[model samples]
Target: MTTPLLTLDTVACTRGGVVLLENVSLNLLPGEARIVQGPNGSGKTTLLRTIAGLQPPSAGKLQAEDGAIAYAAHADGLKGTLTVAENLAFWASLFGTEDIETAMSAYSLLDLRNRHAGALSAGQKRRVGLARLLVTACPVWVLDEPTVSLDAASVELFADAIRQHLGRGGAALIATHIDLGLKAQVLDVAAFRPAHRSDGAFDEAFL
Candidate 1:
């Protein structure tokens, strides 16, 4: 069998001396897409950050093939001063790739190439961030609320791009509250909640 693209074993997290999650385990195989759904403050963002290696888990082991993952967060992470094309060019350079133009065209951002990212609307900035994903040859994508400010058409475009990625043997972990219209395995964080708290108020230190 092929090796799983990602594995998390007995993971736990604590923030500000509070336990956010405990004993969480997951394995993601190539070409798989997992949707993480939870109500507000359910550690959904924390889980994504942990998987992306942005935040260290308080305990447990998380492993992945080096350089195989790319993470896109709710914040577009764009430089307000940089033009859309310049921003993509910078990311592509850092990744040692040169397909920025292709990505821009794919996302229909070619016409807006000269516009500063901050000047664009919320949806446009999201598109710019999403376009960065295409320039990388990474196999794993971790997206946090990728469709937050997108229109219906842009949402469809994003979905289509993700479908193509999966078709190319890539895996994805998405934290979203809405349906992304893709074939994905659901990972409901609600199941991991402690039994005592039926109020739906997530304690930061459940782990």
Candidate 2:
């Protein structure tokens, strides 16, 4: 059997003394794509953040094979001062990868290479952010609302990129309200809510 890329065992989170998730568990395997869906305030973003290790879960465990993951959040996280190409090059360098020109072309950002990211439109900034993912060699991607601000054509482009990644044996955990036209296993976070909070801890009944 193939090794799973990610595993979450009884994961839970609390912020400002409120429970976000309670005993959430899931696993991701190679070449599999999972979509996380929930209404606002359902702890979708909190779950992604916890999985990315940006925020520690208040309970349970998250396990990964190693350093084969890339995470893209809702905020573009681009440096406004840098030109599109400059930002891509910087990330590529950190990943020890080359082919910046090709990566930009794939994301349809070749024409905007010389433009400062801050000066770009919202959709353009989002494209630049997506371009950074292509430069990384990581095998697993955790994307939060990747389709935000993208036009229909650009959305299709992004979907094609994701398909290619999965076709190459990469796995993804995407959190988005908008559909990206790719088949994905779905995880609904609302099912894991706790019945009550007692002594600042989530009730274990939901687990």
Question: Each model's RMSD to truth, in Å?
Answer: 3.4, 3.5
Each candidate's number of clashing pairs is 4, 0
How many Å off is the CA of 183 in candidate 2?
1.3
lDDT of 1 by residue, 42-113 (tens): 788888888888878878999999888999998888999999999999999998898898788878999999
TM-score of each: 0.91, 0.92
Q: After superposing candidate 2 on the true structure, give the runs of residues whose Cα lies further than 4 Å from its correct spot.
A: 198-207
lDDT of 2 at 128: 86
Instruction: Go through the candidates in order and give each one's C-alpha lDDT.
Output: 0.86, 0.86
Residue range 1-207, candidate 2, lDDT tens digits = 988889999999765567878999988888899999989988888888888888778789989966677889989889999999999999999988987886798789988999999899999899888888889878889999999999999999899889998998898999988878788988998887777755344444334
In candidate 2 the C-alpha lDDT for residue 152 amounts to 94
Assess the local accuracy of residue 144 in candidate 2 as a C-alpha lDDT between 0 and 100.
91
Question: What TM-score does prediction 1 earn?
Answer: 0.91
